[model samples]
Target chain A: MTHKKNTKAIKLVTMIMLTSVAQAQVTINQKLTASIYSDNKNGVEGDDGYKLIEERLEIRGNGQNIEAYARIDLTKFIDAPSSDYRDDERLERLLTSYHLGDWRIDIGDIHLEMGRGIALSLKPIESAGVDTALRGGQMAYQSKKIEFNIFGGEANPANLDTLSQKHVVDTPDRIIGIRGQIQANKALPTIGIFGIYLKPDDQKLNELLNAEKEDQNITTGITIQAREILNTFDIYIEGDYQKRRLIDQEETGKAIYSTIDLTIKETIILIEGIYLNGFEQRGSPHTATDTRVSYNRPPTLERIDQEVLETRDILGGRIRLERPIISEDYVGHINGMYRIQSPDSEEEITQIHGYAGLEIYLPDKLAFSGGYRDERYSGGALKGEKLKSMIHGEGDLTVGLEGYELHAQSTNELRRRPSDGDSGGEKRYARGSTLLGLERGGRMGLTLEYGYDTEKEGVRQHFFAGIAHWKFLEGQKLRLAAGTQRGGVKCIAGICREYPAFAGARFEWLGHF
Target chain B: MKYTLLAALLLSLSAPQSRADERPLAPEIKGKSTQDELINVADYKGKTTIILFWATWCAPCKKAIPEFIKIQEEIGEDKIQIIAINMDDAQTRSRVKSTIKRNKWKMPIILDTDGTIAKKINSTNSAPYTVVIDKQGKIAYSEEGYTSDNAEKWAERLKKLSTEP
Candidate 1:
């Protein structure tokens, strides 16, 4: 009961439940964004003139059912801070919530998920601007089938030098959790339970692994989940066990995840599995399972791509198939995966992945799609052990006339190795893009784009103009872009992120309020 | 990596030609309407509204809802109102009210379901976005996507917002 008296009794019960959820009703909303980045060949810090000026402000407030939020970020580089006063490179986020009666309380920075987030989660992957929010305290409850959640926190401590030295170094160490659920509505099927506690801060793991340890380790875990089943086959399963006590050392770990879904008459099938052992593969896979939260890393199969064997000592399986080919405006898809990794213990690695897709609809205004992917790797850390392969292909097309709109896209890749000197000398890449648009009735639009990349033998051109005039404002938007861009992976619901390459001018102005 | 699509289309044609002629009001938009009534867009104060938003799995909001129902039947609703909205999702709100009542679309339709007034006007991440106001309610223009040359620039900006003032 001493960790500075339990952090001053959780900050005096979060300042008396946020001062009784701040009386009455009040409102305030704000959003502002500004971005500018200059000529940077090959990005994510490849350093070439590399200019960037980003600003963001978000403010929210509501009272009555209580709500409060804050976000501020500002950064300037390469022309070194001349947007005249950016309050010295800012960075902040805050939140508060309250709702009494069936309970729901939160205090400062928290974004949580429990059942399927394995044990805990604070999602946000925004192309790698990973924000794992949690400077926390939370409590939730619901009736009519019972539910519960409890939290205590510390995370959100990455300051990548807050736009270069605005401060924040290492501050990791604290987490507490509780999750519960039970339902009897759909004639019983849901059940969940979770418990977590962690306390490690060997100086924030020696400032992210520069090494330095003297035990402080605590770590503990437990989870169990069971989801709907028999409603035309819908079953989800989870199990975890953990224990770590290292002042003198002691460890125990386990993990397993499962999913099965089926819906016939119009296809839909999914089967998934994951297994882990030992030191729960360094636990903390951003606990809060049921996957989803990879603004930039931390997604272990949900639309599988195990990010290179997520946390090693593995065993994975996946099979997914979706349907509606021919009639439902054409559609067909498939996915497959297999994994058996060990990370290290001398030879024991295997991975395989496959994907297939098709979508086609044509009746007055064309549309088409195509896909293929295959990957394989063998033998742990293969030095001379051979066996590696990769193949990918993609295609898309769209055309709609009468006011004009056309689109085209393509992708290709191949890779193989017998030490890259055999197996038909593989290794190839391709990229393509094309867009042409013209609009006038819905208030204006003009577009032209052409992009290409045979792996960097660049070529890009884009011109876009849009207008929906009200002029003075309502929610202003003006976007302008100039040239060379090639950076992949972007997803906004299925989470993915990774966007880097850029070359030259880009402008965007959006307003609401 | 040298850019030259005619100098980036002449610098995006000089960034939208600088507009900005007085704007501010807008930002309140209450919901329901596809007969569930309870509309409330500042009670259409003195006309000229627009709104739009849309979503039916967006293909430019299904090609911009019949060009905003042919500019709300050639600007009439007592001189401009439009509305539309419908950011779909209540499991597709009865297939978007049976596809806007089988495309009869008499123009005023609301329903932002759970996106609380399109996240209170932030337009919940694009979907054929649109907004316009001016009948002295300020907020004049906004657009996101949908082009066939934007319906005669939204009817010459609603015929100069019906001759402003």
Candidate 2:
């Protein structure tokens, strides 16, 4: 019955959007991506080789007081054995925004962000290939001094699992959100209060052995932002209190994320802190695996490449200082952090990390940036503990050659792989990707890529790939890439995702009308 | 799926093949600059504007922004303008102010904390993504990723747009 209702609603929205497009100016865009790769050749990869294709189309229409949007996705697998992946087609997203005086109404998909996301953040994370939205409507009122927003709907997640090349678990949770903000004016700071409530589908939660239904799953927070308050300092503070039940047990969570910045001329000094104690929320319903889905992604207060596990019961902060080099396009920074975290059962672990780096840019578009980091982990109830460190750099060099340009872009990570057990020694490896290409008019290019490595799969392996691209028509690109790239653990916004290795050829075309 | 794609392609072909300057105005947007000031893109209607989306962790962005600043200076504010939009999420939100200050940027840096502007403009969501708006507030052109090759063409295009009525 719900499926039928959704279909009917989708048809209605589509009709409305089509009507709007015919009446108002429209922007049409689409992306077509197809790949053929070797999989399941060995352990943990896949069962076999296959070919797959996906297409996404988006259309937007704007009128005097109304805006309409529609997006659809289609994916297919060809000549493949029975496997985890599946072929499907569906309307991915639809949104209609209507404006009336100082009030606005949004129906279909809604994106919400409260403060620094300690209470709620429903959007997209490109690195994780995650884009979750509230499939409902929102009402917002805005004026010179105040803003209010409220919305409720089912939390819908992107169905495609890029890493697994399969459909994600299709379970959604009901959610409601409310927010009110006071615009900062004069010497006063801007303040806001926000809340998000979630209730998982009982049947889906029952599929998990130890899960339980809850009366209410809510997270509420307040934020205070003071910019240039002291002629040199800017401060942002947010606190959240969560009341949720996922496991058979009942528990609550709390989190606080704050940052203070001292800005002077071309230098900035920052002090940041993060305190999260059981601050977890249900994401994409009850999935047996991948449980670190806290809708409120607290800041990690660490580097994006920091190799560390995230903990709900985490307490830590970092201090960073950055400055420019005298009117030139050069920058430098230093940072340090310390944290104590636990896995809800084990003893708390202590971690300390520090890093520094410099970036250089030339007038001719040649640039280089490099950094070094050292992180130590100990004091936990573990068998092996040690310090982790790495050096990373990335840049591009462009040179003009007789009627053409020769360009090279690369990113590198050289790190010390810590020992797995108490007795094993450490191993060192360099994993960085480089692309070298030559272009005639910046419209067409052929490139070769190599040197990126991975070893977590028990062996040190290297990767190589090649690409050919052409920019045709007004705004269109056709790109083809073939390579074997090993995947590993990558973190974004304090959450981590593991990607499986890939050996394949892929084709993509992006266009806008 | 094939039929759907075919239909989409046909629809694209039927779209009015007009110049980007003839396109409708860039979606009206409002955001807060890193320096704690509210700004609306609509305010830039009479001037040629360049909207560039970037992130702190994007390597190419580090290379592209300096040149963009240089372009803004050379073209002069009376003719062309550049408004940067930072696309960092909460995990990296704290870096925006420091990053901007460290670069000594005088241009307003719009912070897209919630991605509303990106969604409204149909952003590619890639770092170094850039769009050009003509004096009439119409979207003239856009490009994804940054390279030395694109910079030369983009600068030329900006100059061309600045010369228009």
Q: Give the top-scoring candidate (DockQ).
A: 2
Please provide, for model 1 over A74-180, each residue's C-alpha lDDT reduced to its tens digit, 9 standing for 90 to 100: 55455533332223333355556666556777676675544344334455433334445566678877554666778877655434332222234334456677777
- Clashing pairs in model 2, backbone N/Cα/C closer than 3 A: A40-A46
Relative to the unseen true structure, what is the C-alpha lDDT of residue B61 in candidate 1, on a scale of 0 to 100?
63
lDDT against the true structure, each candidate: 0.51, 0.73
Q: Tell me the native contact fraction for each prediction.
A: 0.13, 0.36
For each candidate, how many residue pairs have backbone atoms clashing (under 3 Å)? 30, 1
Tens-place lDDT per residue, model 2, A143-250, is 656788999887666677766666765555678889988865757888889888887654445455645554457889998888887688999998889887665556
Indicate the TM-score of model 2.
0.89
| Per-residue lDDT of model 2, residues B1-165, tens digit only | 643763465465437634443575566666767755666676788899888899887766776887777777788888888889898988888988877766667777888888877887745777778888888877888777776556667778888889998
DockQ of candidates 1 onward, in order?
0.06, 0.43
